[model samples]
Target: MNRQHWLTAAVLGIALPAACLSACGQDRGGFKQIDQSFSPDASVDAPDCRHQCSLDGRSIVEACTGTVVETCPDHLACGGAKCIEPCAAAAEDRSSNGCDFYFQSPQLMKRLPPSCYAAFVVNTSNQPVELSLELAGEPVDVSKTMFLTKPGSATLLQHTGPIPVGESVIVFLSDASPEMPRNIEWELSYKACPAGVTPATFAQTLTGGTGVGSSFRLQTNAPVSLAAMYPFGGATSYVPTAGLILPVASWAKEHILVNGWEASESGSPGIQIVASEDETEVTILPKRDIQDGEGVKGGRAGRPAKYMLGKGQYLRIVQDEELTGSIITSTKPTTSFGGHSCGDVPATAATCDILAQQIPAFEHWGSEYVGVAYRPRLGNEHEAVPYRIVAARDGTMLEYDPEIPPGAPTMMNAGETVTFRQGTGDAFVVRTQDTEHPIYVAAYMTGSSGDGKTAKSYGGRGDPEFVNIVPAGQYLNAYSFYADPTFGETSLVVVRAKLRGEFRDVWLECAGNLTGWKPVGTRGEYEYLRVDLARNGRAGESFGESICQNGLQRMKSEGPFTATLWGWDYAASYAYPGGMAQRKLVEAPLGSVH
Candidate 1:
């Protein structure tokens, strides 16, 4: 096997064993427990009105003919109490109600590495959606926004031009009221452009979009998948970072944060929160003292600090402190995102770039995860990258493939964190044995400077960036995603699951079949592939071939799979999952919402 192609499944406590195919055996799927059978047994009628409220009992509605639960999660219509998607062709997939989405580009930097931001919204709905862009504190032409009428079609949210990097500016988007029943997916991006390029010269996707903005909130009447890019570096260079934006429906009151690479001088890695409802009260128990930033007050470590934000308003904090394991609980659903302002990977690498990921609420944290290493700069043999692990509960224990530094390390308490690097050049996997004690992991790309001499430079190989590792249990069968045109290279990393010990085929709309998927670890059911997109600079390099369209593309497979987008420019880069089902895999112990 090609050395760079080998991957591992990293379990919690950050354990990622080398070649688990034999050891993983048939028990790989049991890493976590997921109750997908949301419906009651068919042919068994409801006992009576008295038993209707039992988790698996008939609904309280008069009919009592369908599933016991009021609604089937993952959008399924129950048949004889079995949860299934509606086969009857209709205007839209009736399983999702994720219409309202809110987005805010994080404060990616505090200094030089200048760049711009952009947003993409893909129409996954069956009917045309009259879409519009909304924002305040800045003004430009908003009339260029168009109506999306076809499925799989995408459009750029129109904007005037690149806004300077500072506090995030708010952008709002939504579908026409009449088009309430719909589904859409959106992605936000940033491209490395010349410092003084005219407004007309900025890079754009195939579908010319509304330019870049700081933050955006969308209130449509359909379900939508969203993601964003966090790129900040000198003009012509960057370190791209991305996040799989979850639907607002899954946004919750409680969250535990895991931020990326940190260096004191670059600026602090921090949190950005946006209010979804009026007069929302949010309290933060910072793991480190938060240095106050725009609209946010600094909070003492381990001390509770409160802030109030109105609907659509947001708070951004970037400083020198590390915010990992910080606890944030809000009174209403509020969108939250976090990442490092700008820092070098391995600290000594040449220049610095940004890192950011939209934080999934504690309820959405999954137990089973595969830690696939980002592609190393081919020919450089620059194989090793950094990994950070954060524990969500007390007494969380973890083990890894090959132990290093604090051998057999474990989190001594809830909200504890452990940071480590992979055995230089080796790709590892980390899995959690218990679902009740789920954890969060962030994968990081090292700096471009091989020896730590360069600084404030552009296009120095790859700089720094990070994305949260989405768990295997949250993989989806199909995805509508886009790659930012701003980067010189774009690729998708896929983790495929097995069915009865056989690997299934994955299809990328333009690339036909995704070939060269290697088995992951020791499990017969998992495989991993890192395919460069159609326009990647290294398109024809063996396993590095472009698998599909450069941007605004679609992919599907016979079984569940996870796709993460990665892109890079001079010294710039960004990465984020295509999308993931926001499952409530782990929940707060009863009555303890925070």
Candidate 2:
């Protein structure tokens, strides 16, 4: 960079320290030129005004005497001062009447890398001005002139070559002297060159389809764009530019952060980008069957079962069996059978019996004669049939009869009552006595009977055979029942409790406290019992009495025992009895109860 200054003067004069006066030719006598190279001796006579006086190539003319001599052309102004063009003789000295000319040029413009181009400025004045270039706030190598020519002047300069990227260079111009105007303009241009270009690379790539396994790949020095689509609509696209790519390990973290799909690499070689259905969330597993609600085990020959989608939304990759196209959603709840038969047969004769052969002490109990039964009714007609009553309650197995009794209730009315009972001596005696008991009942009507006897038949009723019974201090367990033919429909088992001498309290506990127990059918039997803490009266009230049994037995020697109750009524093809029993209670340490 270069810095320069210029100077200008208006008045012309030549004064000697101590000298006498002399005169030259008098024509055009008011003006005189002076030579600045020479100085007058003290004994020499200096030129007065006009004539032949020279100092620094300027002269003091006699145009104005005693007041101050004026300098004209062809003279070196003493003390390096020069005259303005078209100068005219003046009568008196004017303090502000000095040099009136100004110097100026176009504003300077610059770019980096000196070799690329050059810049310059023009000075219209009679004086010359110096120029310099500064780069990045520092001066660079450039030419320096002792003096610049006056007026109608121009200077061309080049910036230092090999300028690094991102550096700015500025061109500065100034007059060599302070007396001159610094009004200089600058114009800058650079050589043509192509703009720098960089190629885009792959930074991250996500691979996965909706409801399918997906993976991601991240690469250095690469740009990546990702697009995702869901079952409903297009998801989102992720594009990372240079310096904006996320860390590679972020994609492998558990529960990775993502706008929609998260990235992970914990169980896979590549980045695992996961997305889920709006209705279901999915998990990524290294091997199949490793998801929740599934059993993952080593397969034959040490290989693992291939990953597959189970009932819910999940993604797993395994090595063994193929799991493609095996995703099932909304599987039905399962029902297990334990040595039970659903066909029509006597409980004792059936190959698969629900109850173990053991007679209860209460042989006259209303549940003893009950058996599982099926009655098909279409329109106003009744087509009673026998079904092997699987014991829902645990107890002794009873017999079942396919033939309906001669005087059994008919289905002439829509809501007519049908009564069925069993027992060697009297069935009604036991039913009419015990009015307080919980019973399980279920009813279902089918469109057709497979027996071929009826085109459209509806039958089958029974409460859920499985019940959860909790002892005061013991955890709840399955309390099942055995079915006998004495009970009607098997589905109509009603639980009723007898109170006082007249069987005044016949009720069922559905909700809330025991005060809200509703009356039940006294004639029917209940097969299952789900017992929770019975609410006594007010909130948190305790119901006293510890001996509780609803067809389940707690033995001191044996852990827990189960019984099944099954039966059918005479009105149906067979009697279907449904009820449960509770064994004798045993005392245990209060602290040991659970």
Query: Tens digit of lDDT per residue, candidate 1, span 1-594?
Result: 000111121100012212221233234344443332211211112233321211211122223322234554533333333443322211122111245566755544432212344444454433333333444423333333321112212223333333221111112222213222222111112233223222211222221111122445554332344455443222243445566666566687888766665654434465677776778998878777877554456777878878887666666665555676778888897767776655656554545566678877776676556667655565332356567777787666454333332322344346766666653235345655566777787777766654425322223555677877776556656677656554556657888775324566887766677877776455345678776662345332233344343556577765567788767656667787876656556645412333
Candidate 2: Cα lDDT at 337: 7
Candidate 2: stretches off by over 4 Å: 1-342, 345-448, 454-456, 459-492, 502-510, 513-579, 582-594
Global CA lDDT of candidate 1, please?
A: 0.51
lDDT accuracy of residue 339 in candidate 1:
67
lDDT values, one for every candidate:
0.51, 0.19
Error of 1 at 538 (Å): 6.3
